[model samples]
Target: MNMKLFIFIVLISPLLASLSSFILKNKRFAEYISLLASSLDIIGAFIILYFVLNFKPIFLFNNAIAIDKFSAYLILLVSIVYFLSSIYSISYMRLAINNEKMTENEFFRYELFFNLFAFTMLIAPMINNMAVYLIDIELTTITSSFLVISEVTEKSIEAAWKYILVVSSGISLALLGTILFYLSGNIPGSANIVSSLDWTVLGLNAVYLNEGIVRIAFVLIVIGLGTKVGLAPMHTWVPDAYSEAPSPVSAMLSASLENVALYGIIRYFGIAGKSLGFGYPEVILITIGIFSIFIGVMGIIYQNSSKRLFAYSSIEHMGIITLGFGLGGIFGTFGALLQMLGHTLTKSTMYFGAGNFLHKFKTKNIKKIKGVFHIMPKTAFLFSIGSVALIGVPPSVIFISEFLIILQSLKDGYYLVAVILIGFLLAAFISLLTKSGSMVFGKADENFKAERGDFSPFSYVPMLLPLAASLILGFYIPNGLHNLLIGIVHIINFKIK
Candidate 1:
């Protein structure tokens, strides 16, 4: 098949699925359509990745759309989460309708927004124009915020409201930054650049951009997109949105959407590094990265809700990734990219487990839920292992990434930064394990008899797949993935020698 054909399918499948789902809202087959659409997207993502590795970056629409290794990898990540979330939704939405009094209309709306949400994220990484990419990120916010309110309680509505308002404000700031980027290009003594917002154009002409304007624009980009990426200080809406959204939506938001937003920051990082030198952007990334780690660990230490606990963990992991990119050596950049994959796998697994717990135990409170090992043995086992992996346990992909990051920090002679990184990692490890252990093994309330097994194969299987992959990749990264990460590192153009 022509690669553009696949790209078209990748971009169009979800819209078709969303429309089909809305029309077929009364039918039980809507979920199957969703799964099929996501399956097609997965195939398309692989095709794009394969072509990018073997051939060249795929371009369409006169360069308006482009898919390189970095973009392909992101598409694959988003598709993977979308596929799993679709499968898990089969059981999750059913339970919501049967047990939680969720109406059919609410379920239908959930499917509609769910497919649209995935669509927005899928197209984001493929856009060649940075401005358009940011617009797509904003669209993701709007679509996923509706998913946040799928069940429409007061809290869910509030979460959705906060999500839209904060992220919109952040995006507005990013727009100002983007305009500055254009202005930098159009300034005096600079040749008029028609496509200033195109990443390709900006990248090629980065040296010509006004230095002071570039600095200010980079900061605005980070702050604006950082809000969407769930970086702290801009992260207040994240916990609420993740906690209140349906588990499948929460999984996508944390596992895939944040990465999509972060992709924008990293792109700008590349531009800024090219224009203003790596040191300036590196320092900015590292400072925010460390502070986010602190805030996330603190939140995990005191969290009472299971969903919110993982939300904080997401922030911590994002911090780690940001720090890795900031460190800017082969090890640091490679570790950060690897951490992105590890996080997508492990965090999604953990969220799936949390979703199951919510369905089976009817609560998100950490204290109220107990003896998951007895209530749902398989989910408990997987969730426990996922928690360990999430905290960088040995033989998990996270461990490798964290280790690589620490090695880079030490190698760079940033002794204090290394110590702080390790301290935060240890803190997160202890706090997360303690919280998950309690939920898995704590005594069940005397009157809390419910079920004695997992929700469905759909629920636990998705958790197991990612957990197993993380474990295997920890021991060995396949050649294809290794090369893909290397390609991305090259694209980021950071080297220490």
Candidate 2:
């Protein structure tokens, strides 16, 4: 019953918030309701995490709902973003309505889809069926694409369309891969015919599935879900969409949605690794992960738009997490899990800061927006610090996580992989810091007429909270978080054992 209550709070609150926001048509009311809903979700996520850590995996309603440590972790990550984005939204949307000329209807629509997007991500990890999970992901795309165009302009519309088309194509392939997995176990020649598509059943019976088919299905799953994870080649839509979306939506997209998408991929990785012996699946992830990192860094170096710079940074960070999981050691998996939390905190902070910049300068171009420190000292401090954390500097959780992945690569005798990874990290470190640094400390335009203050307490508070957490986690890994991540590593692979 307690489990049910937790589930109810986590899943129902956002939905209720979405409905109330749409029906009320009052912007302030919508903001508070969304904030209230996200607050509830944060409490529920922590409760769920506690239960998962203390007790057995929670399976409810005839195995339709499953909450393991892994699922609980993802839930916690999503809810954190939901809460922060909600707070930041109050300031962001207000500025949009005032400065950017956003209408009430548009704000209503934003609240509606924003909460709905949070709902989809929160529920995804708990769904037992892989097909159903993929479908839930599709629901996320629909809701978030709407969010991408929340401000409603030509570029936003184009980005939304591109996001839908590319990600939808990817979803279709994932669905196809799901179909193949079911067939792989059902083929007549098999000793045990797999009777279910539930992740619980498939994971336990992975070895029984036909290896030949599992191989192809996993690759298809990669390309399909990888598109959503913002892996290179399929990541073309990410920059445009994130650049065009409202900063809150961009944070959800890069920080929360990408993690949820990658969670699906890692599930398949576990099953595929169990069936195909970690080598094949690990290679695929490593190869793709490295290439994606290369693409992300290259994009970062050449990026002109502030939002787009961080969008590409999202791609790069996702690649690192992917590489960590692909390495598949205790250090690797643990690092990847920790990295998820760090990325959530820091990326949201960065995007929130970016949103503040957008409202202040009325442009996304990095060069055009100058002297943030002189204009908005509070935001500049947080944004500058957030960028350092984002780029994996020392005493940041990102730094620790990236270091662990590097350690794992060397431990596994992937010397060349380590070398290349270090090089890319260096390039990203220089490029991101230089780009973001200029905006913060460079000279302000002489004719600039915008106000010299931050937007509101709401704007900087959200950024301050996450940036602090990200830094703290770097200096200290709380015992509970450490235990939780270790549990997840055990869940993902035999390396921990």
Candidate that would win on TM-score? 2
lDDT of 2 at 69: 96
lDDT of 1 by residue, 1-497 (tens): 48878888998999999999898665477889999999999998998899999889888899999788999999999999999999999989988988999988888899999999999999999999988898899999999999999998999999999999999999999999999998888886657553458887788778888889999999999999999999988999999999999999999999999899999999999999999999999999999999999999999999999999999999999999999999988899999999999999999999989999998888999999889998899999999999999999998999999999999999989889999999999999898999999999998787987757778788888899989999999999999999999989998874443
Could you tell me which 10 consecutive residues in candidate 1 have the lowest summed lDDT? 187-196
Candidate 2 pairs with clashing backbones: none
Off by over 4 Å in 1: 189-195, 494-497
Could you say which candidate leads in lDDT?
A: 2
Q: After superposition, how far is residue 192 of candidate 2 from its true place, in Å?
A: 0.4
**For residues 1-497, could you state the per-residue lDDT of candidate 2 as single tens digits?**
37998899889999999999899788778999999999999999999999989888999999999999999999999999999999999999989988888998899999999999999999999999999999999999999999998988999999999999999999999999999999888998767998899988999999899999999999999999999999998999999999999999999999999999999999999999888899999999999999999999999999899999999999999999999999989988888888899999999999999999999999999999899999999999999999999888998999999999999999999999999999999999999999999999999999999868888899999999999999999999999999999989988995456
lDDT scores in order: 0.92, 0.94
TM-scores across all candidates?
0.98, 0.99
For model 2, the run of ten residues with the poorest summed lDDT: 488-497
TM-score of 1: 0.98
